[model samples]
Every structure is written in structure tokens, then in C-alpha cells.
Target: MTIISVYYTAKMTDADHKELLEARLADIRRVGDTVNLLTVIEEGFESNAVRSKNERNFSKEVNPYVRKSAVVGATGMMKVTVASLKMFSKREIQEFDNETSATAWLRDELEVKA
Candidate 1:
């Protein structure tokens, strides 16, 4: 199984965030079915209506290409954001406290499916 990792850094502007999202989407399209690890360990998530909408759209756009997805370092409001994305995308996304565990879960999930 192919696994792709995408990281969101701390204190990103909306434009920066959108750029990363688009890049990830391109990777997903290129790779087809893939397991994804999204690390937001130091992300300073803020509530913004535009960003939220873009996130929802991204979730929808990437859903079909993602075979399994895991998120690391989602705490506080980030947890809520992840949950919302899962719901909106109707995709099962696992959450973990650290990247190692998240990657393990994603790998195991793909192995099981295989």
C-alpha cells in the first residue's frame, strides 16, 4: 500500500493552508488509492468561515482517493475540526496523539484491507 504524508505547520495563513491542501489533492490524484498521514502537531488552528469552507471542500475532493486516513496532534478545537471533516466527507479517519501511532494505524488498516 502506498502511504503519503502531509504536514501543516503552525500559524499558517489561509492562503498557505489552501496551497498545501491543493498540493495534497494533486498528490492524491496522482497516486490514486493511498493511505494518508496528516500531521498538525504545532498547527495553530483558528476559526475562520472561509478556511472552514475550504476545508470541507478539500475533504470532499480528497475522499475518493483516500483509502485510509489518520491524523496526528489534533487537540482542543482541532479535534472538532477533524470530526467535522470526517462527518462532511463521510470518511473514516482515525486520530492519534503522535505521528508514530497514527502511521502505524494507517499501515495496519491498509494491511487489513489488502
Candidate 2:
């Protein structure tokens, strides 16, 4: 499994966010198939219409490479965003309060699937 942190993208401009998304997509593709532990743990990580559209597209693009997925630091309204992503991607993305719990869950899930 790989842990990809995109929390730094919190509060970024739309253009910057799109650029980072492209970079992250490249990284994910390089890593190939695995359980992806995505950390979106940042206070200002809110999404707008444009960001939401980018994210939906991202979810689809990464769907083939991501064997399983989990996220941490999705508090308040971010939970809604994650839920929306989950539905759009048709991927069961489990949420955790912190990185430790999320990583552990991903590990356990991988073992079960194995």
C-alpha cells in the first residue's frame, strides 16, 4: 500500500489544485495497483464546484490503479465531499479520524482481500 498526502492542497487556488492533481495522478500511476491511503487532513481543505469536478475526474482516473482506498482527516463538511467522491468513483472509501487508524484499516483490508 501507498500513502499519498494531498493535505497540502488545502486552501489552494483552483489552478494550483488542478496542477497538483495532475502531479498526484502521475505519482499514483507510477506506483501502480495498491491500496491507496489518501490523507486529506487539513483544516482548510474545502472543495468548490471546480475542485469538486476535478476530484470526480480524478476519482475516475485513479479508479483502475487503486485496489482499495481510505482517507483520513475528513471532518465536518469534508465528510460530505468524501461521500460524494465515494459514490462517483463507485469505490468504497472508508474514513478514519487519523492516519494511524486509516493505515491500519487499509492494512487489514488488504490482508482480507489477499
Candidate 3:
């Protein structure tokens, strides 16, 4: 199994966002060993934005390594949520609101890795 680091759980206030981003950066920078896998959990509008920005930031922070961007929110079944995710970008960023969707992505990526 690939090692993973979960950032933490919190609402996205401006200060918290700054602190979390810095901490995340530090965590990756300090990792003398490479991180093969990463997972982030987010909710709400502000949290969504924070996670989105974090994805971009972390993507830059961890160049050359493939990072998984799994956005967890109420999606699928209802077409609205899918539209929302699509709005983020043209790329099909895998999304989930619960374990089922998340695990599905995990399985898909893991198989590809194998």
C-alpha cells in the first residue's frame, strides 16, 4: 500500500486556510521519503474552494508525482453535482460524497498502479 497523509479536518476560515497550506507544504517538504499517495477531505463552499486551491498548490508542491484530487461532496445521481465539478475545469476530476465513490476511485487508481 502506498503511504498517505491526511491534512486534517476543519472549516476553511482565511487564517485556517493559510495555516493549513503552510503545514501541508512543510509536511511534503520534510518528507525525505516520497509520498506515493495523498488524500484530502473537504466540504461546503469555502472548504471546496480551499481544497481546490490546495490541489493546485500541492500539485505544484509535489511535482513529478501523480497526486489524486478526490473532491468529496454531494455528487452523482443528481446531475447538478456533476455539473458543479465540471465547472471547476474541463478535466474529469473524480468526485465523491461518501465512501462508495471514494473507494471506487481508490480501486481504479490502485489497479492502474498495479
**Lowest lDDT 10-residue stretch of candidate 1:** 105-114
Task: Output the better candidate (2/3) by TM-score.
Answer: 2
Per-residue CA lDDT of model 2 for 50-94, tens digit only, reads: 977887787778877776577777776667877777677755687
Please give the clash total of every predicted structure, in order. Answer: 0, 0, 0
Give the alpha carbon lDDT tens digit for every residue of 9-30 in model 1: 6778889888988887888788
By the lDDT metric, which is better: model 1 or model 3? 1
The reply for model 3, stretches above 4 Å from the true place, is 1-10, 32-42, 47-55, 74-93, 107-114
Instruction: Show model 1 residue runs off by greater than 4 Å.
Output: 109-114
Pairs clashing in candidate 1? Answer: none
Model 3, 38-102: lDDT tens per residue? Answer: 34454433345555565556555654333344445432232343355346543334545564555
In model 3, how large is the Cα lDDT of residue 76?
A: 27
Best by TM-score: 1
Order the candidates by lDDT, highest first.
1, 2, 3
